[model samples]
Target chain A: MTAILKMKGLGFSYGSRVVLNGLSLAVEEGEMMGLVGANGAGKTTLLRLVSGVLKPREGRVELAGVDLPGLRPRDRARLVAVVPQSPSAPQGFTALELVLMGRNPHLGLLQWEGPRDLEACRRAMELTLTWDLASRPLSSLSGGERQRVFIARALAQEGRLLLLDEPTAHLDIGYQPAILDMIEEIRKETRITVLAAMHDLTLAAQYCHRIAILHEGAIYALGKPGDVLTPENVSAAFGASVHIGEHPVYHTPVVLPLGRRGDDG
Target chain B: MGLARNRRPPREAVHPSPGARLLSLPYLSSHLAVALLALVVIVIVAGGIGSVYIPPLDMLKIVADKAPLLSLEHTWPESWDTIIWQIRFPRVILAVLVGGALAISGATYQGLFRNPIADPYLIGVASGAGLGATLLLVTELPIYSHGLSLLPIAAFAGGLLAVSIAYSIARQSGGLPLTTLILAGVAISSLASAAISLLIIRSDPDVRPVLAWLLGGFGGTQWRDVQIVLPYLVPGVVIMIAYSRILNLFQVDEDEARQLGVNVERTKLILIGAASLTTAAAVSVSGLIGFVGLIAPHAVRLIWRHDHRVLLPLSMMVGAGFLVLSDLVARTIVSPSELPVGVVTAFCGGPFFLYLLRRRGRVTL
Candidate 1:
């Protein structure tokens, strides 16, 4: 399959500190690529670069063969949608209002949302099981509810590529798989590409078709979950010795971290 | 788990289309009608009352006579015509225009900065205008001609220059940080205030007129003053109202707005520029009125939804009506000796502001 998102020699820095250096990755059409990395390992920065929120210091990002930096924001948004980690939802806006904003990328500056736009928003909300919270203020929703609402918004954008930063970071155990499953269903239905930064290695292994392990500021390993998420790779990248086992049903890798020196509580 | 178990039936599913409930035409029209009626009543009643109290019927007749199509009998004395048409009429209209301009600009500022305390004058317009007016007064420029004064022109230039300076200082890496913007504004405002004080101290002993102007009043207003301000105020206000939808997007952080296809930096600059124009125009004509900008938007938010499409226009009306009523009190409460309209707004706005803080407990920007 052709790559929907291509990052060539991506480099970024925060003042003097380099976060991503010569980082290259590609997400193929209609595939879910999981990004696994240790804390401060530039996962969020990579997603930001892909979403065109931050300009790369060097190299380029291409969305469907077009240079992302050269495109206007509205045009770029039409090709890519992003769900940031723990996005701050402004108070007094209803869940429906927030979701309808997803249509903004598609609408003109002076255009209000029409019937088709509202229909798409409603469908996205229903798919995420957030239609009941449509009239509720964002401030009133729980963290999980807010995350689902944001995910619904990204879905409403109808972009060819979706970028999510720690989408399940704040979800409960019950919701973690549910939200991921909803994304998987959406990908199947729409044939869209997804690049999600996942902290849960086992969950990533279960949901993502392929996994890329990031260490420091480079890709440590990239391939199928079984090939990339080996015990040695997880230990080396995360500084945690982990026992890797297979899932009983799906037969995918399941990571269990071992306790470090002298800490048994 | 609890969320799924206690799920309420989807309200959106019941409606044929989404946003129908929130965008109900009947609800919006009813509220609009009530506000429009209140505004009309206040304009008529306030026009009737002054140092010389003309009855509401006589005020209506005076207005009717002025209308080209309506040839009403001129039973009322000719002085009533001058008072109602030439003097009081223009003053009331000025109050409405200035008040509407200030309030809508305030709403725009608050939405752009995402801060409840952000007022139109937050970025040095008041002090800069004051300094400009004071300079013109002290120098005694012979530029006043045909009911047009050079003071307002100087004030407008000063206000725009001050805001531009603050904007440039606060902008970094093509982003405007709110804290930095506020700090820059405060610094510039203090510097302008110092200049105004110095000018006042060095000027001749006859500074009462300048002092009174600084205090802010609708006194001595004529059709000419209204005409002078309309060119700036009307366009600035229209631009702000046009961008109300974009302003709603700004309530979120800049990155979020940009991701939603809003040109965040460009929109911010345009909004700030438009708001500054309105503020400078209003202040130049009426001399530094306080609280209308800050209070009117807050009042509208308390009653109506925070959607800027509705909030902007409603706040304008509220501001216009509020100042008209306040000007009425300023002229009559003491009777024969008028108070500056700004003093009354502050007196009323202060308590209302405090009440808001106490009631809400915490501010949501």
Candidate 2:
């Protein structure tokens, strides 16, 4: 199977400080991978590079074996849809209208949203379980509801690759699991590969087929979540005494940090 | 959260009003019908009730005489003919064009800044035009010798220069930061204001003409003024409308817009250039007609939905109709002694603004 996305010898810098240097990664078809990182770990930057929102200072990024930057915006958009951390919807557009914007890449030069576009929007919303909220303004939705709406938009893009930056940043536990479940469902149903930045280690370990643990702008570990989220690696990365054991319910790796105590001489 | 807590429904269903619930997508016809009717009525009433007070019947006659298909021998009193033909019509047309220009410019600025209170003059256009007009007046450049010929060119040059400076300042690292543009505009406006004051202080005969122009009026708009404004207005309005697609993309975030196949930098440059040209053309002829710019778009958005495709074109028509009526009121309110059209617009716009604030708390700023 061809790699859907490949980054080779990539480098990025902000003035004197380098973010991603000589780092490379490839994602094959039909995989749901989680980008695990702490705050300021350059996970967002990496996703931006893949989304074509930022220019890579060195090396090449390819989508489906074709080089990036040469593809037209519409063409690239047709292949990869990105869900930003927190993107604002223009005030007063309903959830359906917002989702229909994803179909913009497939539109003809002078085309307005037609019956087919509306159908696509409805299907995406239905899949995300946001069809009931179709008429509500995006601003009126709860944080979890809004994230689903963003996901719905990505789904409506009909792209094979989806890039999500911190998709669960604002959700409570109930909603976080629901969102991850929805992403898993989407990947399975549509065969669309997902690369999502996730903050919750348990959620990442549970849902992601593979996880890349990113630290200080480079990948510290990339493999099955069982290997990557080990206790020693977790301690080294987050500087916390962590417990790594199977989840009580899901049988996935559960990371529990030790509370500060007086016995740690 | 607390406010909504107090207003919790008797039942927990999210649907508030089933009857008036918005459709999944808003359509144009129902939303625009009322505004269009009001605008039409306003234009008709305003066209008849100018300083000369041409009766509706006689006004129809004058129009009939001009119409090619209507072969009626419509005769009017000589004085009425001259006043209607030579004075009021051109003034009304100028009012329409000027008002349309300013309102559209204001709408563009509001969109560009993503702020409701943003005005066209936020970018130093007013001050730049003021400086150019003041210079012409103080130097006795013989520019304004033949009606309003030189005013547009001078004001256009000045406005373009100021915008170029603001644009340069706003661009720091290839991207145009909106906050930077606004700050630069403020600085540029202050500089132009200082220049104007200096010119006024050392003026021959106190430079009252420039001051009156700054205060704004439609006192002497004529056919010549119309001629000078048309070249800029037609092209500028066309370009603005053509770029309406880009404007829609602008409502999205900048990076997102770029990913949607818009070249953001090029679009901004085109929009800024067109808006500035329109402002210069209008300001040169009518001096500095104020609140028409700010109010027309607000009224359109308040009355209708917030789709710019409908909003932009309707705003133009509503703007034209509004200023014509305001100019008519300015002319006829005091009979032979007319108030400045700017004063009428401000008086009307102020109360409307206050009402908007009180009623629609979300839209005030």
Candidate 3:
């Protein structure tokens, strides 16, 4: 498959401290890639770099063969959409209004959202199962419902690539799988490339076509779930012992951390 | 979390038809029409019942006589004609313009900062204009000439300078932090206010007029003053209203807005410049009228939608009516002795705001 997103030797720093250091990765079109790492492994930073929210100090990111950093923000948004981790929903905005804002890239400065735009917004909300909540203020929604709304907003953008930064963070277990299922379904139908930063190893392995393990701002391993999620790689990158087995339902690799370096029962 | 579970399911199912939304086209136009009607009624009532009362019918006649197409017979006393035509008319118009400018700018500032409490004067306009007006009052310069007063110009320049310093200080490599910007503005405002105090102490004899101007009243507003402010106020308000839809996007975080194709930095600069210009123009004419900026937009949000397209124009009309009423109370509450219009606004707005907070249990925006 042709690569839809290419990052070549990306480097980013906050002041003197380095966050992402010469990291390179590529995501093929219509592929669902899971990014797994420990805390501060630069997963969010990498996504920001790819989305052009933060510029790279070294190397470059190209989305659909266009240099992401070179394009104006409006142009960049047309090719890529991001679902931020635990984004604060704006108060007083209904779910529909928030979703409609995703059409900003497609609209001119003075243009209002017309019937076609509303139809798109409605479709996105309906797909996310948030159509009934269109009139409800964001502050009133549950965390899981709000996350679905944010996913709908990204869907409404109609971009070819989607970057989700820990989309399931802060969600309860029941809602987490539902959201992931919805995203997987959308990917199957729309064929949009997805790069999701996933903290839940077993869930990521179940849903993703391939998994990339990041350690110290570099990819330590990249392969199918069963190959890349070996105990040795997991122990090395996460510095914890884990039991790896096949999931009962899907026969995919399942990861369960045993304990820290030295923990006695 | 508990509230989320206990709360009723959203009122409607997955997708209600667009027609059911209260902010639809017809409702919005009707809301605007009602607000416009309220403003006209308030203007007529306020014009008729100032310190000197002209009957409502006479007020209408005064307005009609000025119309080019309709020539009405002028049967009222000549001095009443002068009071209605020359003095009260211009003062009411100035009140409307200045009030509308401050309220609209206040709404823009609140949206840009994403804080409901943010007001037009939060960016140092009041203190800077106060310093400039005080300096002009004390210096005994040949300020009034050729139908121009240097006081307003100096005040406008000072307001712009203060905001520029605050904004530059608050800006960082990525974007402006709202907290830093507000803190910087407060620091600059304090410095300007200190300078004004020093000037007041040095010019002991002229302190009374300086103090009066700082308190903010429409005691001697003339048609000339209205003419002077219109050039800045009209265009500034129009530009602000034009950007209302974009202003709604700013309610989100800057990074989010940028990701959604908003030119965040450029939009911020343009909005800040327009809001400052409008606030400075209003301040130069009315001195430091507090609470109109804070209360007018909040009042609009309390009843109507928070969308800026609806909020901005309705706030302008509400603000105009509010100030005209406040000025009327200022001139009439004590009859021969007048209170500053600013005092009346604070007295009215503070309690109304507290009542809203108590009623809503928390701020909505």
Better of 1 and 2 by TM-score: 1
Error of 2 at B60 (Å): 2.0
RMSD of candidate 3 to true structure, Å: 3.1
Check candidate 1 and list the clashing pairs: none
Quote the lDDT for A87 in model 3: 80
Tens digit of per-residue lDDT, candidate 2, span B1-365: 22123222243343322222222224655555666676656655566776456677777777667777777664667687777777777788888888889888888877766777787788888889888878887886787555446766777778778878888988877678788888999999999999989999888866667777787877866788888888988888887766664566677787776655566777787888888888888887888788887898888887765656666666777888889888888888898887878888899999988887888676722
Q: Which residue pairs in model 3 clash with each other?
A: A131-B14, A132-B13, A132-B14
> Mind giving the per-residue lDDT tens digits that candidate 3 earns over B216-239?
999989998898899999888988
Interface RMSD of each: 3.2, 6.6, 4.5
DockQ-based class of model 2: acceptable
- Provide the lDDT at B203 for model 3: 81
Ten-residue segment with the worst summed lDDT in candidate 2 chain A? A107-116
Q: Give the winner by DockQ.
A: 3
After superposing candidate 1, which stretches have Cα over 4 Å from the reference?
Answer: A262-265, B2-30, B140-147
Q: Which digits, one per residue and each the tens of the lDDT, describe model 2 over residues A154-249?
A: 888898899988887887766677677778877888999889998889889999988988776677888899989988777766766777889888
**In order, how many clashes per candidate?**
0, 0, 3
